[model samples]
Target: MKTGVMLSCLGIGVLGLTACGGAASSALDSYKPATVNTPEDAKRWAKNASAPNVYLSSTAVLGITGLNGQGQAEDTTCPKRNQDGNTLWLEGDCTDSEGRKWVGKARRESEAAGSDTGRFVYEGFGYEGTDTCGGKEIAGKWIFEGVVDVTGTEEEIHFDIDVRTDFTGPDEDADCAVSDESMAWDYTGTVVEDGSSKNTWSGSGRVGSSKIGVATVETKDEVIDMSVCDSEAISGTTTLTGGSDTVVITYDGATDCESSSTVQWSLNGEAKGELTGVSCASAGSAPAWALLAWPAVMLLWRRRSRDVRGGRGRRRI
Candidate 1:
């Protein structure tokens, strides 16, 4: 379905490039609906309307932290680092085999340098890059600031993150059919070693040229079991509203890591559709922009961790 294609294109920018083009058309700032006269109509509207949840998930926030849902660094492209007194500066450019390019810089300060216990604060961390996938080329930028606190002998870790992103691309289909396309969002969340997390997201943008107007995403406590799943919100609700029509999506909780989840969709207070299996974490999901954008920052942290703790890695708390 074009729903997956829309997500794949958005995923191309998660860790992507600079914003070089005009801002997405403001006309896409509000939802403009197609006629919904049948269950099929409601089904299509529900899928497209609820698609943004994929990008709004905690997984996307983790992408900004340069870590996957599994709390592992998956990107190998590292940015250059320079040590300046107690502060470490990272700046450089990297290109992946897929021809995606990333350029950015970040500043981090060590709270307790040369001590067995380590605490770091990341300031002014951001990057921009671009990638082409599923017949679309996306360019975007990401900016974030957070603190990583490590305490005790086991070196328990905890982090609070805030992130902002702006991405622009042609909203198109597999055949290269162009439509309205753009996305921008703000995401914030926290992850602890116990595999629990909470997130809140809000944004106004377009997916596959479809206007999302203003939307907010939220996940319940322990809704995403990091030990069992990779950033999928096994239980949560996302609401999208424009004019008098509204769409709501509910993700049914699961027990294991599954590619798809059971979801229910409703429009204007009426049930429209229910699907037993909906892919939410695959490479082709909406966070594909993150897959491409996060590597540069991920590489930076991987290098930093290697230089510290003598190869003993820090678990994401």
Candidate 2:
């Protein structure tokens, strides 16, 4: 399928570089997706360059890129959690069970020996920058804080940039056939649960400046939310910027899980097509977002009330 779309959500800012030699140094092209950045001197020392308690959070992204005619991509992270009691950090293509996957494991250096730190090891599927077997390219870092639980009918999470991939390379790996490079975006999202098996997250994102010029995509409150579990499916819609366009998301499947869920997005109710892989995480494990808004009870209640009620609309998809 088309993996390029997946990179869109993960932030493909690794493009637009000026490489002098033909050596494929970074993890993506190395075929060693998982082990892209072992504890090298420069890279290792950079870890301590941040706060002590901050660990990386794991992310599993599956989506299509608009560039490569909406190609498909899946990415995950290893060592599900960090030493600082944080979840695993992730980068590109975590869902592929078969491919040049990046499996990360942390090791504890002896603290008595003037070192008691964790080091991550990336193991690629095959030797020579190629999975050979599954052809997967992966790279990214993780920094996480503990999960904060929201004390409401819904779950919420709070986090920061605990893990990030390197963004140093040519503007575009255009010749590679797949535009699967690091990209970035600046947007906000919200997830509302309409029912047990139905939920939706909608947000806006923009592209960062690399070799490729800056590109901004505004959803304009364009909500892409859905709930699909076992018996029934729910749908939702949000208007985008410029008011000329809108995306309507629909779910068709079960009511509690996302497996085999069919999500279709439409513009002004016109069927765009079937969206194969759509992954979005609006809140963190913790209710951090909720906690921050707690001080403003009136505001918090209003937002939560809208979420629940808005979910009930259930119009035709």
Candidate 3:
């Protein structure tokens, strides 16, 4: 999970390196325009963005809703909660086993079912005594717009999450060379009593000057059983569109017996990387895509600034 969050941040912060290479274009070109034309279109978008890892993603939100240290059992935290009418509000400070402190806030409808439905409003920020979450100072401020919709009955739970976040970047003096990222995620999923479900997710965002996107697009789907999420196999696949090019990746998650996952990536049906270690765990605040894009994003970051006809400096998205 740390890997996924860190790696995803790589895409988020590193994408800012506009001159990173044509790689960003190819890896994220599949996504469409930023605006939604209709409610149905928005619904479809929300559904897809919530896929890939429904249980984990939902749990991730749940952890944030309660500031439970991102659901890491080993972490210690103190939190405050309040209920008013149909809504519940939460705020808290938590310290991970490693002593990193996470502070976050979340508000949501108290009910989990029926037409009224459940939705969450969340904001989270983390910092060490200085910057501790990632070697790149991964712990910054994460703010969310849009509400996460909760559907289904007790026997089954479906989540429709469409989140747009404007991430606060670090100061000019920072250990991590990563840039600020503005991202939007639309995804949906349903988990049954058996802990099995189907999910489709997609996202597009800007990391500085670079643009990035990822989605299942029109691929054959898979039925995932979260309860049995022991890795060791190709868990899923998605097309990553960056800049102007696309890359296909087959993801293999961390087996119950292992600490890391691997990915097989290709472009035009040719292998891009074999046995690349990726963050496949579901225990950190980092998004999974970040882990998958780590190696490639770092390469893009190393490439440098975009070709600006006029001027260049950090501009907040």
lDDT of each: 0.35, 0.23, 0.35
lDDT of 1 by residue, 1-317 (tens): 11111222122111111122312223224435434334444333333333233232212423433432333433445444577776666554764332333355555454545432333333434444443444455554433333333233322222222222233332333343333333332322222223233322222332222333333333233244434455344555655444455666666555434455556667788886675333332222221112112222211101111111001122222
Error (Å) of candidate 1 at residue 263 is 1.5
Using Cα atoms with residue i matched to residue i, what is each candidate's TM-score against the true structure? 0.46, 0.31, 0.48
Ten-residue region with minimum lDDT total, candidate 1: 301-310
RMSD of each: 10.9, 17.8, 12.8
Q: Write the per-residue lDDT of candidate 3 for residues 1-317, one digit (tens) a residue.
A: 13112212211111111122222233234344432222322222222232333223322323322232222223324335676777767565755444434466667674632223466665552222223233444444433344455655544555554444443433323344445654443444443333233222222222211233343331223323334443322355544433344455565442332334444556555665644233332221222111121111212222222221111111111
Candidate 2 Cα outliers beyond 4 Å, as residue runs: 1-58, 61-129, 133-154, 158-180, 192-200, 207-233, 238-264, 268-317
lDDT of 1 at 224: 42
**Of the candidates numbered 1 and 2, which has the greater lDDT value?**
1
Better of 2 and 3 by lDDT: 3
Q: What is residue 267's positional error in candidate 1, in angstroms?
A: 2.9
Count clashing residue pairs per candidate: 21, 71, 38
